[model samples]
Target chain A: MKAATTSETAEREARRNRIRLMQGNEACAEGALAAGCRFFAGYPITPSSEIGEYLALHLPRVGGNFIQMEDEIASMAAIIGASLAGVKSMTATSGPGFSLKQENLGFACIAEIPCVVVNVMRGGPSTGLPTGPSQGDFMQARWGTHGDHPIVVLAPYSVREVFTETIRAFNLSESFRTPVILLMDEVLAHMREKVILPEPAECPAVDRLRPTGPPEAYLPYASDRDVSPLAPFGSGYRFHVTGLYHDETGFPTGSPAKIRQQMERLMGKMERGAGQIQRFELTGAVSGGSDPVDTLVVAYGSTARAAKHAVGEARQSKRSVALFRPVTLWPFPEAAIRQVSGSVRRVVVPEMSLGQLAGEVQKCIPPKAELRRVNRVDGIPIAPEEILDAIVA
Target chain B: MANRIEVRFSGSGGQGIILSGVILAEAAAIYDNKNAVQSQSYGPEARGGASKAEVIISDGDIDYPKATNIDILLALTQVACDKYTPDLKEGGVLIVDSQEVLAIPEGNFRAYSIPIFRLAQEKVGKRIVANIIALGALVGLTGVVSRKALEEAVLSRVPRGTEDLNLTALRAGFEEAERLQRAEA
Candidate 1:
């Protein structure tokens, strides 16, 4: 590629600095492209179709590929295959499609493929409220696939965070050699907000670690480090990839000892590196100053937007309240919540699902810290007033 | 008072209701350098069903992306007007199509019944620009966004060949709004 002229560079800089309005789904696509995601395979689904639509138009322009797969199942499988071919790959889906992708999602999990799956959650169980907003998939993101497999799930509330977090999802997946789930609710998926996106140079992309030793000596599933380096298929390194329990050399193993070792290594990589994967926000009365927070609101995804507003409303009336939002939903920010719970008298967890997140918070906070849940299964975004009512109650 | 204003555009689907909200938000955020968030809620149907789109523009950060306290409500159809009128804030502004929305619900707000669709059809020579006319009327009545900004936003959004017609429709809406204010005076 020829280098850009000075005027072109200046114009590009000018465009980069402007604050543009972006929808949450558009941001996800842009973030994926910026993060060097060169391949996308997704089946169209409501609330998530826009991501694939945008990628379909722009991916080819950036020298990337976007394929409309036959179904959600094939979409998941194609991305895994593309990733194994040394491409940063992604796929997006919503509730019913998320369920469809789970069996393959579990395959990606056990095989430890580095891919990003964006689940723009709508009301669920089966095709329930396709256009409505719901965080019904909150728990499903954690254990949707039937296994004690490791996973990383990141939830973002605003369009700007959607862009940044999608990039982070790619990074975490690449670094950890595991699939990362970018969970977005319908409200956040469709909402448009003013966002000044960072240039590609500002947010550096992370590539999957590759085998450095001779191809003949490479073990596809073996590592002394926390994350084993993966060699791309047809990179002169030949190895088997399978969902079954395998030894270090990548052949299926029947030994209980090797099975235990494989499971331990897979789960242990995420457990030991949980701290680096966690991202959260603490605002309003976080410090132990004179105005210490007595009421704590823990929320994530679209619900956190309302909780943030409610926290502001509570503080206006001279109430001690703060908002603790976990951007990284899985590998729950337990230590931070426990520390904050020590200071607060009451803890409120608001989410779109009935006590999905609240149940998790209950386990983290102290028993004496009165836990209140403000939940909605009606497919409407939780209002700030509802959270405020919970705060004062 | 918080430096935030919530506006809602309600009409049947395929009437550019969501586009009106998006254009307003883009004008506020891109041209006016203000914070804006736009969201919409609609049924599965792509057309005919009542659709509502909301934009919250603020001098500060906008939390809670949806409209809670609507300062301005634009209803292009009677169904939309009936469904959403209850959410308008006290002393808010309600703009509706004069022909379609005949029976306005009583509220503690100012109501302007403009022939939005007729103006787009008769004056602008196109019925599809009714949403642009409504957008112009919206800005003219409230000044939620600057006129120049709205024009720029509209031009950027509409197709390349139809800028002139859309601009004429926008001006027609603005003139209609000015006429209403003059009549009140």
Candidate 2:
């Protein structure tokens, strides 16, 4: 009887971790919930509507709030407001909506508000392809907001990574006190795959650092520390918030020294913590093997999946090729790229855009290395065969 | 079973083609202890536009999610059959709805033209469950996933009160597939 009971308990425990057939958008919502996101505000858009729809039905059940704002700008503003009120907040949108959120996104940056933004990329300059996939926003995510600001953008390749990357987006946002963008392409947003998610206990949630000093003595934008603690609005601690360049006291300042200090501290936080924020994966280059790969394939998002298949095919044909995929797209993983590309003379980058990511990779590799690009802008994904041809050619 | 099989279900948008692919992927990944990835391409129309959903099931990891060399092609309309027949591998399995896809294209593959929609309407008393019926025949024809797992996935996805109706439609397709198998033998 005792043995049977123990076996039954084990079976139930295993069942609790059952594999789920999850879509990428669905996994993002689950990740937000796991990261303790208690507020979501967004306008529904193509390739990203499911994330909003899922949260609309499930957020209230978990005692979280979900609001459908009138427009993308308001959606971004609402999340900023929620974050100021001591809640972990997020907003999800696609290409066009991402464009509309740029103004508020910059506001969040200048204000140093902690929030999450999910950009499910699709073909675009204006509302190009609603259901199609594209990575055209690769550079836009970094520089779209107009000024010099520190931002973190994470691009997940598969459904499993979508879950983990979304959680990491929240964690990095809170840790840096800056808005983080979870970049996902159309294919990654809509594709479904089997994922056994990590349990809550396994992936501990992270909250923003709180001010320990007296409420009256708090400085919202203190430059002395690497990251100044942010106290929620309406709390005992009162502080001013604005879009202008501010001093350590959280009020606007015209003094050049104060402006320089604030800007330096804002950019320095990321510079010192780049090691903890940047993530990349390297494969096909054996550590101890003598055959150094002469070709390096750089990719991210869904395109990386095709690149991975092509890399495996090349290896089977006795070709020396390696793959470098960046899980964190921003603060660009330059150090890892330089280290891996030192031995290779050829670097191939395949993306849905003409050459967004290729442009960035060009600045990092050896000056003598040849950069080859395989681009697809016809609203169709780059196939594995195309990548294989690039690898061998 | 082969190391990997790529299956594509092509039909009109409202015909539940994507949902059929989703159920098959869930059955294989959740119950059979395999890796499965499902993806789709659809136009902006909510209904009537040509839509295709593809599933890749493998014993190992699935790198590329889209189906290139299709092992199984299930077309519910003539337009879909004409469009996707060229993607099928030689000696691949092609299943189409006989009533809807009247002019079947020539292909280097095994073809099974079943009265899928008609059977759902006549035997199951509902035309909306044709996707479920088609799923049963596809599984019965290939044995790609276990029947128990298929039933479980179907029940979990369908509406609460419609389990009995959907099961009856599924069993009808299975019976028809069995008859075809016996005739070939």
Candidate 3:
């Protein structure tokens, strides 16, 4: 992949391969741009607003389009429109805004529109803490929207991972022809750190499967080939797209047979890409040994940082502890979590939310293992000391 | 984590203390090639509200990005000085504005009384650049980031046409802190 040396892309290329200390929100915007996204529509919300600010300032320079819609609903609708027009599009919002976008989120999923929606999570059941961090949206990202349709939610731990994970989000969204939620908490969104960004040549980019035939031969919702090829609207592919359960031809069909097939297809696309989407980092308890550690720690996002540090601290005191970090939240890597579960006598799951991820981990915990929870809901992140205390206790 | 140094800047919002924290983290992470994380507490109001920013610089990865045991605290106002003093580690350095601060709390930490705001207003001709002056003084006392790297970080973030005044403020800060250290020695 060569730089788009044209005047439009010169500004974008100038930013690549630089060592800049950047906030996670800013890096995510740059990452989206690098992944070939050319359209953005977002509403301003604290913590995640920097992403909109950065994109609004720089998107025009790179020949991209940006619109601040009236609210999150319109913002989500606008990105789906842009994506259906054959342009890569995205939107960023915090919890309240994310809640507003839920209906449209389901629309994009059933319609097979390739778009990215970024939810920088804050403490919330309802605008709970606008400027503080929380992982309370863990289940919301998966089950918030109305249907049984599949979702791809990717979480990042650091400034650099936010960049790379965003690129992966876009690629997976386009590759799977679905809406991918790039989940971030307030801590990851607002915290600034150094990142060694990849050169534009190395950053991966993927385009949606396009139709190879004339408009007459196109099937907008066909899933015979895994992810159906999405023909750009107005590109002569006159296909119906709707929120209702649809048939293979992209037209709504209420018949039970067609509905079953369409629903299965929506679920099957992610199932096919599960291996590619699932990622986990596993470390032994004793640092240098492959011995079956008696205890294991499981975490994700910002809490993973605390869990990791606590694992190291626990090991320093000769308390055997291992760490399992799932970078992908949805399609929860149950297999990996279960692999380490049967052997460890105890498993600890610490989360900023009361017990969302911990509840999910309970399903995979080995029956013999005693499940421990180090839960916090005070709008502050779980510190290493808290997790370490749980480990030693 | 022992190799990490944690620093915090606290003052009212208009004092630009948050930007100083950003610059210090940038100087270490980018120019000095160390890992750093900068974060802040955003108050409801933009000015006169309590504003605090923290940066954790380390030679390796930093987990738990917020400050656990603050190594250095720069308090530009009495409210900040009083509120943040408890979080300071044992023997940590606490620098406060001598003119604005009337009392110094007795603690295990080393306390320094520097007229940073006065130095900016009187020497640099703008009290708004006091954060930069404090930044210069902090680096001089701690030797955390090199003088040149801090200067580059400060100049890059400061607005155009005012770079000279900010540079003057930073230098004045270095000289004043060095004088205090020499006198104490």
Candidate 4:
């Protein structure tokens, strides 16, 4: 993928500032467009197929390129190649397709290339329920690629939230210089809602930091700076990128001291930027100076919506329930969760999967507050009534 | 305020069950300034399948977006009505095509049997717009959404040059609904 140097020119042609009824997948595509994504390569899969379809139809009109790759692995490779060419790129897929892209996802993580991978989660050990909703990929999203590489994952609950979060995903990927995962479940990917999209000019987007130094002086993996600024391939800066543990010069090396330095810096970028990437919403008593919340519900994606509604309904019935919605799923916002969970007696983690997120929440909160989990794997999105019942009972 | 209403549109595929649900949701959300979400049965949500599309409209943010306990059901087929009727809330409204669905199930929810598709074919000159006709009758019977909002919403989404036919079907649907309401009373 040759770098299209027309992202600025393309924005002039994009549909700007309009309120329209949009599905969640369409919102994600629109968000990618707003974030100046200029390249898309993906194979179609249920639920997530709409994202690729929407982009295929509209990307060219905005002067971006959308290719239907031979398979999911090629789709993943193509996006990384485009990103290296200095263009923002993305791919969308469901669980099985996502599983196929894992090797390249590991490649992108080890190489520290900026890109976005949208996984619209579905039931699966393997093609379990093609069109149904599932958060079963929560662990796979973070650890599926194999290795201890840092990643940023954002989950949006509403159509509007998905739009903004997609843009945030691209911005985070660019700023952090890592591939960011916009983790969506089948429910959010297929549901349609009214979204008032902001004008293109109003969207805040970040381009990857580039090296301003002379080509000979460039160190692609240098840890002296907070982030190693990347220069586009064929842009007069000659550099080598390898998945192997490389020193600052982007070449392969096997020295223990050098490998440790590179890994720590790779990991430390997320550790230092966790505050910027961590986004969560605290609702109910946590929002006011009322009595301390006895139960704090920690949730994400579609489950969080049900949790929020349950908290609202419970508050009406004189229950001390609060909601902690993690807009950012990975680089798990443990500090914020811990803080809001301070006054609460217990933290309830509800998810479509069987205790994926709950296991992580359990590790963060003190033992003084019990950690409770409400899990379902029947491929049905968790109903709010179930959360409400859990809250009251 | 609990201005939340759940509406389900069920029929065979290609009848625009999903589109009609979206139109109803857009009318409430875009034109009437409400929070609305529409979702459909995922696996076989295509034409000729047992398809049902649902919309939840609320004055506030919606939680539990699916129509677990439907307040209104527009069943264009007997199969749709039979498969979906049990989930209707007590005192909810069930609107069915009287011509297509001969035996209506007895339930606590009020039932309105109107020949929605036949009326669309006879009055509007096209049976394909039956979903729009059913939508019109739905607005007329339940008043869940304003007729003006629904009209604008339909016009915005429907194919170009067919607005007048859809509009006619909508009006005829409203008339049939009014006639049924008077007869039932």
Candidate 5:
């Protein structure tokens, strides 16, 4: 018994040493494993393919299922099917594949299914640059699916953030009963960094909200605590779910009154719970406890890392500059941005796309506040020096 | 901050330039407690097309992970050198494998012509270990990293039994650097 106990302790220590240099996509796969994701279905696409490869190699070892579907459409459908069967499912793709998955994504939205989809963004329009980084998918993630539906999307700037936001994506999807997107660019997806992974004991796992009462009384779409609980298929709550408008019993309904109520409830949970889902980080914005003199740089994803560096350089030259990075892209941080408007004179928005987030910032900031955009759509990150020059000039 | 060295590895695909940058970044970040970031390009055509990896090491917090100006340039192909040479700061170091890179541009920066292929053939008897050989020579020339730390990093990175072969390649690179230093002195 003593020998067996000692061996167990040694095995635990060995597991702890799993910390090694890993690419961002690989770390994301490891994060999904820790998030209790049992089902991953994806198609092979540049940049985002590494995430699929990692899952294919490691998922079975941990008793999870990894499937490579025929294409993005089938991949997304399988994830939704797996999630409804009481499994935490996820799918990842790039710009072209993300475009193909939009129809199924709309299906998930209308069905109010819980799953996570990762878009490791690359240059776009149509397969522009498969390996290069781009943030052209910002507007697409928010408004890609048809109809008026609310969604949650998170952007991770570093490899470490990729790991954490993936877990958050699963948590939010399960809690809200909606498909959550974890948006990453090719730079963060391909770059290798030293990620300090959390110990198993430190990570919190969120399982699907199961029904508690008798199976006969269970209603899959019935509201409770502002969010409805999901009933597994074999659990006897054999309610029909469809892409068409549904009622409280999960059956298709054509009544305008029922349709209006269902849509409101579906959108209300994410809209009302925006405060809890939003996350951002600020640097150099509150220096010397006074109004920021001239420029405030707003960037996200890999571009935010460059913005932080530019802000630091500008400060060294006695220039008053700051950076505002949105960790959560959707449910746009209007309140936090309004706060920034009160303190800054000018806002400079730099992105890998041509003013996608800049347009969002313009809507949020005060009208009188000057808005300058440093836009690049060439599948490369905006350099730090470029932003610093803009700040200094 | 003043003593930190940032090196960039650039070459055509199949040259293992990304792995070389990774080894250096791991040596600096994990073994030396220095802040390091490694970025590379990936694509379907990366096997024979242009490929590059950039490593930035600093004593202070590295806010910008991308390298704008390189301190050392390891160009394995002419196209790689032509693309990146303009980005090297003045008086920077350039190391080229003699067999692959035929022309060395005249500049104030120090240039070393190491027989990386020949050394790989002689020591490890494999062209794939050419990156390990170049990395060894890089350690010898810069002395920014200690041999022991690099050896430990190499041992930890390679396959289970190939640790000794990599270590030998690293030592051969160190000797090549020492010999060059002695010749220059």
Candidate 6:
């Protein structure tokens, strides 16, 4: 009886901690905490400002620091600095702010710093819709910063997924020693839903691997393992880090040999780990374990939810359709699409932006496979019925 | 199984519509052992915008928390009345604070044009408690939630010193509901 009572009490406490009605931004903050993020720096931008506000209120309570930086550039810079100091750090911004942070984001990539940047996307070329939704930043998130570099980006559709993916973003960042972008659209940012927050013990926490042996023996960039160990400042391991090409000892090396080596390692880590980082969900890919789906719907972010609904509606009308939702938008899930392309006869890409993910889908699928694009950019989510019409047509 | 009630509150941004829905949901979920969901919608501009909150209370789990048809529609403004009146289920109740919401629709649904603002002014000496008055009328008309449960929920939610005033406002609403019921009978 005592054992049963104790177990029941534990279960009740767990349920109490879990059930919550949380906004998307609040879920992102909670996810950051669950992922063991200890530092957050950000500037206030509409739709994304609540993330900073939430972190400011909640971070300190959990022994984490939240700083409101002067601008997005400084905010991104501060998070990179915090990451180098051996703390998981993150920053949240919208389009204009994301544009400002791009240079530093590239710097983090070149320097191989593990950090997460959340872009709660709003409508924009420049301040398009401060409060409305837009998925226009899909290409920007991939190639926003100048130069050739690989990135890992994830888009979440719901509040609960926001919590889970923000945690995944931090894990991927640390594991790969690069920045991960949590690309959230404005619809997901402001949407409120019931989310069950995981208990402190239930969350998986990843700390950056630390250097062992004497400080004198440490070579900051020297690594046989795919992931190099990160040495925090003030640990008596003196090392130099710069945006310029560098040697193994961390000194500036302009030599072509050193530059080639550094670039390969930067690119290779993501390439090598691409299999692990690529995430997609395929619904209704097969029927009766033999017949393949003739119609395919490709979507990401907020549009994916509506696309899923469309796929359901299409299936009821005797149309064999399936949905491909890209959970991880970057290190673009090319392999998954290639696999899906083999079976499906026609592909439909619906997005809030003008054919961003559609371009990527076309790149992966064969030319013979019919590809269609359904794009909307009026700051409203694409209705399922519209996609259903496209599939049937 | 006990009867379930879903209420939707609509008003301008600063009118405490979300807070009223939250209080009602908490009353049902925390106090009455019912499953409840509260959802609110507001545009990007936080102020001077149409805002709404939907509260769903059920003995079982609520599958779709979004109100397809509302049981009670509390419209604090003319725009809200025009926008939400059609969404109220047939025979559902409509409560409007007559001072802020000047217009009303004639319909089959039980429409209560409560002098919520005047009652709030007379009892609490402030118009802000008009929502509280409407909430009281809702409780009296439906009896979906017990008075004690709502009173306790309000006390826990409001700030320390303001509990007494809110309680008084709630009791006044309950009294008004009793008077209306007596008159009808």
Q: State which candidate has the highest TM-score.
A: 2
- Per-candidate TM-scores read 0.97, 0.98, 0.95, 0.94, 0.95, 0.86
Q: Fraction of reference contacts reproduced per prediction?
A: 1.00, 0.95, 0.80, 0.73, 0.68, 0.09
Local accuracy of candidate 4 as per-residue lDDT tens digits, A27-70: 99999999999999999998799999999999999999999999
Sorted by TM-score (best first), the order is 2, 1, 3, 5, 4, 6
* DockQ scores of all models, one per candidate: 0.95, 0.94, 0.79, 0.67, 0.63, 0.23
Clashes of each: 0, 0, 0, 1, 0, 0
Worst 10 contiguous positions by lDDT, candidate 1 chain A: A1-10
Residues A195-271 of candidate 2: C-alpha lDDT, one tens digit per residue: 98876777788999888899999998888987888999888999999999999988999999999999999989888
lDDT scores in order? 0.92, 0.92, 0.88, 0.88, 0.85, 0.84
Q: Considering only chain B, what TM-score does candidate 5 achieve?
A: 0.94
- What is the model-wide C-alpha lDDT for candidate 4? 0.88
Model 5 bad stretches (over 4 Å): A1-19, A223-225, A287-293, B1-4
Q: In model 4 chain A, where is the ten-residue run with the lowest total lDDT?
A: A8-17
Stretches of candidate 2 exceeding 4 Å from the true structure: A1-16, A286-289
lDDT of 3 by residue, A26-103 (tens): 989999999988999999998799999999998999999889989999999999999999999999999999999999
* Candidate 5 per-residue lDDT over residues B24-129, each given as its tens digit: 8888777776667789874468488888888887777666678787789988887777777788888998988888888887776888988988999998888888
Query: What global local distance difference test value does model 5 have?
Result: 0.85
Candidate 6: misplaced stretches above 4 Å? A316-318, A366-372, B1-8, B21-46, B53-73, B84-95, B105-112, B135-156, B167-185
**What TM-score is obtained by chain A of candidate 3?**
0.94
What is residue A158's positional error in candidate 6, in angstroms?
A: 2.3
lDDT of 3 at A113: 94
TM-score of chain A of each: 0.96, 0.97, 0.94, 0.94, 0.94, 0.97
Residue B141 local lDDT, model 5: 92
Model 5 chain B: ten consecutive residues of lowest lDDT: B1-10
Mark the 10 consecutive residues where model 3 chain B has the least summed lDDT.
B41-50
Model 1 misplacement above 4 A: A1-17, A287-289
Per prediction, the TM-score for chain B is 0.98, 0.97, 0.97, 0.95, 0.94, 0.94
Instruction: Count clashing pairs, candidate 3.
Output: 0
